[model samples]
Target: MALAKGTRLGPYEILSFIGAGGMGDVYRAWDTRLERDVAIKVLAERLACEPRSLARFRTEAKSIAALSHPNILSIYDAELEHPPLFLVTELLEGVTLRQQIGRSAIPWRRAVQIGSEVADGLATAHDARIIHRDLKPENIFVTARGAIKILDFGLARFKPAFQGKPGSRATTVSEGGSLMGTVGYLAPEQARGETVTAATDIFSLGCVLYEMVSGHRAFNLASPASTLAAILNDDPRPVADYVADVPEELDRWIGHCLRKDEKARPQSARDLGLVLRDLLAEPTAHGRTGAEFESLAVLPFFTSASSPDAEYLADGITETLINQFAQLQHLRVIARSTVFRHKGKDADPIELGRELAVSAVLTGRIFQRGDVLVIAAELINVRDGLHLWGQQYKRPLTDIFAIEEDISREISERLRVRFAPREQSRLVKRYTESPKAYQLYLKGRFLWNKRAIESMRQALRYFEQAVEEDASYARAYAGLADCTSMLAIYGALDPRLGGKRARAAQEMALQIDPDLSEAYASRGFSLLLFDWKFREAESVLRHAVHLNSGDAPAHQWLGFALGLTGQLEEARGAMRIAQQLDPFSASINTTAVFPVYWAHLFEEAIEGFRAAVELHPGYWMAHYYMGLTYAHKGEFGQAILALRHAAEIGDSIWRYSGLGYVYAQAGRPQQARSVLKKLDELGRHQYVPLIYSAAVYAGLGETDQAVEWLRRAAEQRDWMIAWLHVDPIWDSIRSDPRLQGIRVDLGPKP
Candidate 1:
């Protein structure tokens, strides 16, 4: 069906021929119904006669229609059942990449940007469980605006385990036994008739990128067979050979992508996109190109407002910007916890930068008047206290997101940071259209960061309100899960019920946005604290860390999981990473005490907790843990004083239990009995971790009573029981035969 100008196909009037391909002919057309220009791709009659070919064509239309991404070509409609079947897509004014790459080399920066955009599109498609098996220059378009758009998913397939390694080499042919994809860009596994995964697309993109930068195909030969052989066995010429100024890092990245073993290639298209963007961001000085160690800290925005709500808004802006910067994998952004330590302190930018070990510091002053917000921010070079970039944004409250985007973009420009397309979108991505919902979400996050029982409850209210305003807000759901689980862990809610709610909220978050690393980390916490599923918790937490290396909480939770499983040394490594990511975070700093305490290094645990106290003397958890470490070392007097101080700061069953245990150990029977009575009374009125009661009894040397409480704790599924293998508090009860049975039941099942 070669449609001449003025031909009508249903509601579309063909105006001119665009081009023809093996599968179809493309015609520029006008969609009368929508009154818009569209490109119509009509399947060739000869190919349409074959059921398998028609099916593949229809699949392409449907696959593309299901996707919504800037880099992906947009599909409007598909006519499958009617004769002269065709697909409608947005009319793009651009040349196919093949034409754009015609016999000339593209600048390295432009090439990287094009490749990064393509990788971002591939990553989106993979997330939708669709694999673009045909990735080549001919299938990509470079719009007049310089944006890259991927075309032709004609060889796309559905693979739910799309992110996993490719299937075995034996399963290459489609159901109809047709070989798919082009030869030149075929991954080595694909060339060998082996199954392909996202890595296949990555390899293809690498070939395309190499051609773009070098003005030659990466693995072309005199014959198709020879080209396939090159793809399967030979390495392409180093990119630097063609482009003298090409960075060694870029060559290494492309080489990794072109590896013969698909398993050895970049496993994630998103990660590859980040690497490409990093290459563009890497500074070149004196003819040297390498990663610039440009770390930055975002100081909490200063506000002179008397209203607490105004202060919250200022804090939220700082945090949101910090989060936005953290998403740029090429940028080293100090965590909010570490940076907020400078809140209200008039610290010099260079000194603060030295404290945070960042190359630069971002400081801002926020003011609100009626419905308007005024923010003045400046980026300062830490080495010399020199201002690098500064801006003042005065906008309506509803335009807060726009302000953030403008700030982020300007900062990235000044810092020489290049973000992948996805990252660029995420830096300004608004999760809710409603400003109220966004505000509530911000407030929830602010409260949640306080990490107190009452604050968590308040955060829960705000999070619920945020979701009520915007049901699709994934971050709000993640916050909901975090608060719900923390309530249970802190004994503010029933363990069983809190765990169930937390899991449900976490599932909702993942369903809305599976890429949210915070949701996965929160789920890992629920798994560990509620279900006591140590192995599954470890798996989820590790995946969270893999997704976002800068996620301090994920690393912290992974360390917690490792500590519970008795992997002391590995736990220490994870904790160290967490501490580096969040140097001043009291919670993260206190995490080190656990592995040291479990390893029975009482002195180290005490020292670690004391150091945490010095960093945050008001952090009750630090004082509480320090008390436990002291008790373990038989310093009962110091333990009692520390525990009492912790109780004064924030009273909890753990504090009472620690106090009781120390008193008992110090031969103060009356005080120990009184503390036990108080715990009993509190248990009747509020939720209490049975572990606390058991600990008190164990400290009193009451074997039968301790075993009884331990049994109850097991029946109730107390989360602390998961640490039975390594908990130093359980050492006294371990020798008791009945306690051994309880320990066995709590241990990982064979």
Candidate 2:
């Protein structure tokens, strides 16, 4: 399909032949309508004649249009309606990389620059779910202005996903296979004709990068078949082996991209680009590069507003940024519970970063006047206290989403932490388009974090109003589910309500956004406590944590579900992650120690509990749990002291009944009876879970009374009944027929 000079197709005149390839023939052409010089890729005869191939080519050409990166050759149009099918693209004035690299091996830094540019183009396409099946030096052009442009994107599919020629390793795959990549640069999975992903392009890019630095093919052998085998089974020689003064880190980083297991490769092109760019920045940044994971702490945004609603706006900014940053797999964002602890203390960003042991700290001040918001943000490098990035944004409140997106993008660019597609979507995901609904949701979250009974009620009201304002808001529904679950957990509401109100809210949230991990976490809580579906609870909780690994509460809940079902080691592991993410949370720390306490590792549990207690001395929940752990350790005097401290802090059923149970465990029958009597009088006026009384009865060795009370507790749908299958307090009446019957009625089958 060679076109002669002066041949006209549609409005474009083929002025001269440029080159030829398997997919098409390139020609210098005149665009009559746009009155400009352009490059035209005239399709091969087989592709032009086949309707299916033509349609597929047209569809993929549109996908390529989404990638308008400077490093990517711009496609002007896919001319399909004309007799001859062709693609119009930007003309280039530089030699192919194959010609340029033929002179000599490129310098390491220059090679890194080229690789970074290629990666930036790949990132844009990959983020749009487009895969470049073939990438080689000949397909990369180095312009006269020193810029690189990727050629023939989405054109590899003209033959197969790898197109090879028998006995010729010029640039194609073997003849017998349907594979489509150039033989030497084919990724292992592509060589095997397996399904491709964004990682496949990463492997090909690594081969190109290897060639740039070493001035030779990454895996050239005696034949294309031999090269394919090498790609599948062998590691390329390190760039340093072939070139002088190439850093070992650069070699290792390339090796990560060339890994045979695609899973081991960099998950996203943008992430790898950032790593390479950082390596390039090492000389000026005091010779530093990111370690395993870059850690960051986003301190709570300071505010000038006095009203609670206006303050909620500031809290929203801090929380939104933290959630977005946490989604990056290569970044460890400090949890909200930890960062919010220094909210009003005016902590220095440098000091906070050092205290949290993170690479950087992000501090912000937010001021809202009427409908306008003014935000000043700064990202400081912890080591030298240099401002990595800083910006001030003044925008109408209605455009908060755009403002946040710009801030997030700028920060990630400065920090060299780019998000994968999934993470990018999560970062810019707008739960509600309406600014009013967003404000209501933020107020709801602020109230929910307070964790008080009355505040939770207030949070519920706000969440309901948020959804009323925008019925399609998934986050508002997630908030409803979380608030309702907390009320049920604290015995402030009937456990039966979890199956009704909480269940509906969770289902609605999932319906709107099926990947909402927090909603899944709330559903797991209900299944564990109210439905007596222990196995289902653990499965749902596991899925929740899988969706969002940074979710401390999800990990904490999963730990409880695992510990109660006798999976002590796994429970301890989950809790450890929760504790790591939320270091300053008293409840998280105490529950993080729960699996150890339940495993009867008394000394270990004692150490864990004491550490948590010391960190949060005023948290009564920690003191109460320490008492139970001491009782199990047979330290009766210390147990009594802990329980007394718990009772002195709060006189609720948790602390009061817990004291009675510990008193009986210590053999103080008279004191235990007095506490039980006090509970009995109080139960007459309020809704007290009989399970609390049952706990004291079990400790006192009153078998019949405990069994009767357990039956009543099961009838009332009390949450504590779920622990019957695991709690050691019930070991005394382990074989009682009445207790077994109650367990059958209340617990899941082991």
RMSD of each: 21.6, 20.6
Off by over 4 Å in 2: 1-293, 305-309, 743-750
Task: Locate the minimum summed-lDDT window of 10 residues in model 1.
Answer: 741-750
Location of the lowest summed lDDT over 10 successive residues in candidate 2: 160-169
Model 1, runs deviating above 4 Å: 1-285, 288-293, 306-308, 418-421, 735-750
- Tens-place lDDT per residue, model 1, 1-750, is 588888899999999999898888999999887566789999998998898789789889989987877678978898999779999997888688998888466777778878887887898898988889889999999765344689988788777575444552334466766557788888887777776788888999999989988887899899988998898789999998888888888888888988988889899999998788777656566764332346888899988433345788888989888877887878888999988887988666677789788887788777677798777677766654434545557679999888888888878776767676588777777767888898998899889888888888999999999999999999999999999888877777877788888889999999999988899999989878768777788888998987777888899999888878777788899999989888889999997678988889998888899999999999888998898888888898889889999989974466787788778878887898998888889889888877787777888898788889888887776777777767777787777777666542224521
* Clash pairs (backbone) in predicted model 1: none
Error of 2 at 596 (Å): 1.5
Local distance difference test scores for all models:
0.82, 0.80
The TM-score that candidate 2 achieves is: 0.61
Q: Clash number for model 1?
A: 0
- The numbered model that scores best in lDDT is 1
Estimate, for each residue in 567-660, the C-alpha lDDT of model 2 and write its tens digit.
8898889988998998998889988887877676779888988998999898788898888888877888998999899888753566777788
Judge candidate 2 at residue 16 and give its lDDT. 94
